[model samples]
Target: MRAADRFSFNHATAKFWDQREAVEACARAGVGIGLWREPVQEMGLEASAKLVQDAGVAVTSLCRGGFFTDPTPAAIDDNRRAIDEAAALGAPALVLVSGGIPAGGTIDGAREGVQEALSVLAPYAGERGVTLAIEPLHPMFASDRCVVTTIGEALDLAAPFPAEQVGVVVDTYHIWWDPQVWQGIARAGREGRIASFQFADWVTPLPAGVLTGRGQLGDGCIDFKRYLAEVDAAGFTGPIEVELFNDALWARPGAEVLAETKAAFERVVS
Candidate 1:
């Protein structure tokens, strides 16, 4: 199939976009969508689910559901709720961002928290038919955003669970710089653990905070074709969600941003 056929516009790319409009826009373009929980909740889960279902837009994967670095019962409960949401929306995967080091805690201790949390949540996700897709952020985000900084580490955390219950997200913006990324992707595929695939570009001279600095496709240095080729070769023939977190893009009109993103995706990966 063509790359466009697998394109999914992650809502966060246009952070301020109206959720209903975004879903309709994606539907008009015949593309899938990756939804975020806040907006989904705002729209009311049932309403949000009905919107996409009525629009005939596939809900590729839910944006996030993990922050289990501390693994409190509350954290586990929240993840279970997220799993229920994903299942309610007919989303196959719930992307997870292993939270940063907790205060007064070491990174090692935090990782153990993630493992513990997953052991409980993974089974719950499996029961709901949702895959817990662990996402490894760039090492730069290890302290505040995501502690899991490499595909390898994410895989290790997912090792103890069934691939159907727990998997990893292969997002280019985060893993492109890993020298061992190719091997990591291969291993994820071999183990049937590639549950979600995302695309974003890495630009130089990052923004002050770097949290909202992801570049649009082809705007920076990421080699879209290489990532596409590798993931495809690795056997992940699924939706390729472009999930840019750029401030500039977010400031524009949602429809305009979506169009630009779709065009850029085709230009770079097709």
Candidate 2:
């Protein structure tokens, strides 16, 4: 397999560390990177862009861009800016975590909000050469993180748009438990809508918010090799990004974490 065919580390894995150091570590380890938005902004976009460029690391995707469940003008405006940022960093896809239920709102209402928001942003993202990858967070997060909870649902949302403009993110950590996973992957492949493929292990007794408990490769029950086979069979070829949100991992040194993560990914997928 190609080096890029293996795994890329998401900055959220080392959320507690410095952003520049994380990029450098990933490059040195010969792995690509998935960047987050706040750190990029805090370090200054121009500087962050230059740092990644200097390191010669491929950025697989930008961490986020969708939270517009309300579809307010302000929310749409923010996502537009996110698309521009993804383009600036040379990231091919922008991961969209459709916002959760608005206060005093029904989940059905939030779904509508996500659809409306995507309709508004899809064209802009397409014109800018950025694809929006809708990520289906785990069902545990359905209440407050992302309303889109399955690959099938995400594809349904993407059906009306051009494949280049809208797609779905398949993160094993989030969707591994779904019984319909294979069919979902096949559908995404048939539609040419698999924009980003991320990896992380799944463990029990999740953390409080359920946002930062992602396990490292091989540490949990996810069968990554199976996923690789399925995705490849579906004719979807893309970087496999490892996006762990573990608190323990975040507390360690960034370089150490990257080195360990690389080794774990290789062991599991080799």
Candidate 3:
């Protein structure tokens, strides 16, 4: 299939854009989308599901469903609801950002929380035909954002569950700096744990909020072609979701951003 054919826009890339408009745009572009829970909830789960279903656009994966470092009952219950939402939207995977250490808690303890949370949710997700996709953010976010900081680590966390129930998200922006990333991708693929693959460039001179500092494709240090080659070599053939979080891009008109992102994706990785 053509590279463009596999393109999937992540809604977070255009944060302020209307969810319905984003779905329509993806449909018009004949691409797929990765949705988030907030807008889905605002639109009402059933309404959001119907919107995508009517648009005939593939919902590649739901943005998130994990933050169980503390692993309270509330957290576990929320993740279960997230799984149900993914099933409702026909999203095959629910991307998980395992929360960071709680107050006075150690990183190892936080990881344990992730495992505990997964043990409870993986089977629930599988029953709903959704895979729990663990996403390892960059180590810079290890303290406040995600405890899982490497694909290898994410894979290790997913080890106890069946591949169909639990997997990892290979997001370039987060793992590009890791020397072992290529090996991790290969291992994830070999183990059948590649549930989602996303693209984002890493730029220096990060903005005030590092979380929103991801660069557009081809605009930063990440080598898109190499990432594409590596993941492909690892045997993954799924939607290539470009999930940028740049503040500047978010400020632009969503449709224009989508068009530019699509063009950039083709230019850099095709």
The residue pairs that clash in candidate 2, if any, are none
Cα RMSD of all models vs. native, in order, equals 0.7, 1.3, 0.7
Span of ten consecutive residues with least summed lDDT in model 1:
202-211
- lDDT by residue (193-243, candidate 2, tens digit) is 999998899877677746778887887888888998899888877788888
Q: Could you tell me every candidate's TM-score relative to the true structure?
A: 0.99, 0.96, 0.99
Candidate 1 lDDT, 1-270, residue by residue in tens: 887779999999998999999999999999999999999999999999999999999999997998989998898888889999999999999999989999999999999999999999988999999999999999988987799999999999999999999999999999999999999999999999999999999999788858899988987999989888999999999999999888888889999999999999999976
Q: Which should have the higher TM-score, number 1 or number 2?
A: 1
lDDT of 1: 0.93
lDDT of each: 0.93, 0.89, 0.94
The CA lDDT at 171 in model 2 is 91
Worst 10 residues of 2 by lDDT: 1-10
Clashing pairs in 3: none
After superposition, the stretches of candidate 1 with alpha carbons farther than 4 Å from their true spots are: none
Report lDDT (Cα) of residue 51, candidate 2: 89
